[model samples]
Target: MKEIVIIGAGYGGLRTVELLSGNKSFDITLIDKNPYHYMQTEAYGYIAGRFDMSDIAIDLQGLIHGLGPNVTFIRDEAVQIDETAKVIILKEQRLSFDIAVIAVGAKTNFFSFIEGAREHTNGVKNMQRVFEFRQAFEHRLYAKLQNSQNSLNRAGDLHIAIAGAGLSGVEIAAEMAFTLQRYHKIHSEKSQRLEFSLIDAADTILPGMDPYIIKKTEERLHELGIKIYTKAFIEKIQERSITFKDGTILPFDFIIYTAGVKGADLIHTLDTPKNRQDQIIPDETLRLQGSKDIFCIGDCTEIKDAKKVLLPPTAQVAEKSAAYVARSITRLSEEKSLEPFHANVDGVFVALGGKYALGILFKKIRVKGYFAYLLKKLISRSYRFGLEIKVNAGYKKRHVGSHDTLCR
Candidate 1:
């Protein structure tokens, strides 16, 4: 049997396994730092307590068991890729592979625009970071309630600034606005007012998305009292304060860097052509530009569109690329030619909190308000369930939340 090793259990790697695991001719081992697969789309929602943490994770072991005996799961982090020997260097051991697929997803990137940003700020990219921010948020607020109930500016009012007006940034800002408002209404005595801001270097938010969608999103953010700062570059992040390029300092209780993302660090170790974002440049067939046997997919690779422009890294892009890569691998075994990976996006969907949302479907249909929110939920559910190719043995739909201390 030929040994096939896949790295990273994000949507891309996970779906690739589902498509190829049924083949008895191949022995597949999936390696990921975490044993569970997380639904990254809902990561921000979980931080805001809109979704359960457990609901967002899928047990990899359980996923493999249902796939068949041909697939295995390894809970380990990938450190390097020794392309010369065709082996993956893990934290503990080196594994050789006849065919290697690198799908290690993106990481939160604080570009050079902000100095000391990643060190001082927080984000909702993963569960751990979200939990940390929630703890710090409540701890700071509770401390104020106990010490300064009579202080000005709502005692411990928080000034939250989300860097970058992308989808994640906008979603986080909107959800926080809703959650903070809800919290104050419940605990009027100990509550603190929250100030929300979305700062971006670009003049427009969600630049590539339809104008109607962007307009609707701006309106919703306004209604939710979220301030928008466009064409403003964050020059520095120092001790709960953000300084713009103009030397204006804005004090914030917490800062989140949704400004950008770069590919997994492992990609830099490979001798492959990469873009500015550290994303491996993949050929039309979804293979690394230099190697035919080594495949790269998901957020880790930059695959351009028909217009020769790089496509955005989204779950849909990852899933579609995964499918194409799997098909290519199968074709390789059969000595058939591989086809190019094409992306066909439905449109953009923005959840603006509190029974409100905005979306553009099929690049034509405009959806907004409560109807858009429901549609977003429906689309999310459909994608999650559709990807579950294996029967989960130990995976339970349990609820693990944040902000428990504040509720008490």
Candidate 2:
């Protein structure tokens, strides 16, 4: 049997396994830095006390354990991939494979435009930071405010500055606004102070969103008592104060950075075509531009077409890429013709506070409220079930033979 190794057990990597698992022709190994696959969409809800941790996290082991003897799941980081040697080097061992799939995702990009910004801000890259920020918001910041001796002290106000105005930034600001207001209301009854500010570089929040949706989101955030600062750029980010372009300084108790994302730094080491953002440049077939045995997908790759550019960073794009990859790989292994990987965006969904959401469906149909929320949940469930089916099918076919052979 030939060996196949996949990196990063996020949507793309895991889906590839689901498609190829249980094939006796190839041995599969899935590697990731973390043990659990985190659902990025619901992470803010978990942080805002609206949802539990388990809702956004699933054990990678549990998913693969059901895949039986055909697939092996390892908890390790891919330090480097040597295309020449056809091997992957981990911290503890090296994996030699006939084909390798790279799907290591991107990380939050601070841009380093503002000095001390990276150090001073709370990031929403993973689940831990979200909870950590929430903990600080609730316990530390509130405690500092409540115990202040001077009523005129700046600490009592507890200003929060969110650095970016993109989708993640907007969503976080809205959630924080709503949650903090509820927190303040409960605490103020017993006499405690709280305040917040959401700042963005653009003149308005949600830079590219439709005017109606943007206005609605802004209104809702304002209703929660969160101040919005438009057309503001941070010149300096200090430990306690953020200085803007016009020399205005604002003191902040917490700063959340949701500005942008860059491809994983590790991908820079690979001898593949890379974009300015350091994302792998893949051909129409989703294979690394020059390499036949190697494939690249997800946020780590840039998808190009004849007339227009495309973004391959979202979970939706990653999931679709994985499906395309599965079919392509199967055809290649079976010595069949290959097809070009074309991206068809089904929809785009952004969640606001609580059950509120704003979305543009396939036909540009705008959606919000309970129906959009329910659709989001169903999409998540479908993803989980799809993964489960692939693993289970592989295990069922290999279990008895492997068990009986081991006993003999």
Model 2 misplaced regions, further than 4 Å = 141-155, 189-193, 210-212, 304-307, 384-408
- Clash pairs of candidate 1? none
Per-prediction TM-score to the true structure, in the order listed: 0.91, 0.87
Please write out the lDDT profile of model 1 over residues 1-408, one tens digit for every residue: 888899999989988988998789988889988878888887767767677766677776766666766777888889988877888899988899988899998988877667998788875556678778877877876676665446544565778898989888989899988887787676544546678989999888876767788888898899888999999988999988988889998999888888888988898787888989999987777777767788999898987776776778898889888888888888888889987788777677888887788888887888888899899889888767764645443232112221111100
Going through the candidates in order, what is the number of backbone clashes in each?
Answer: 0, 0
lDDT of 1: 0.80
Question: Pick by TM-score: which candidate is best?
Answer: 1
Residue 287 Cα positional deviation in candidate 1, in Å, after optimal superposition: 0.8
Model 2 poorest ten-residue lDDT run:
399-408
| Candidate 1 similarity to native, TM-score | 0.91
Model 1, position 237: C-alpha lDDT score? 92
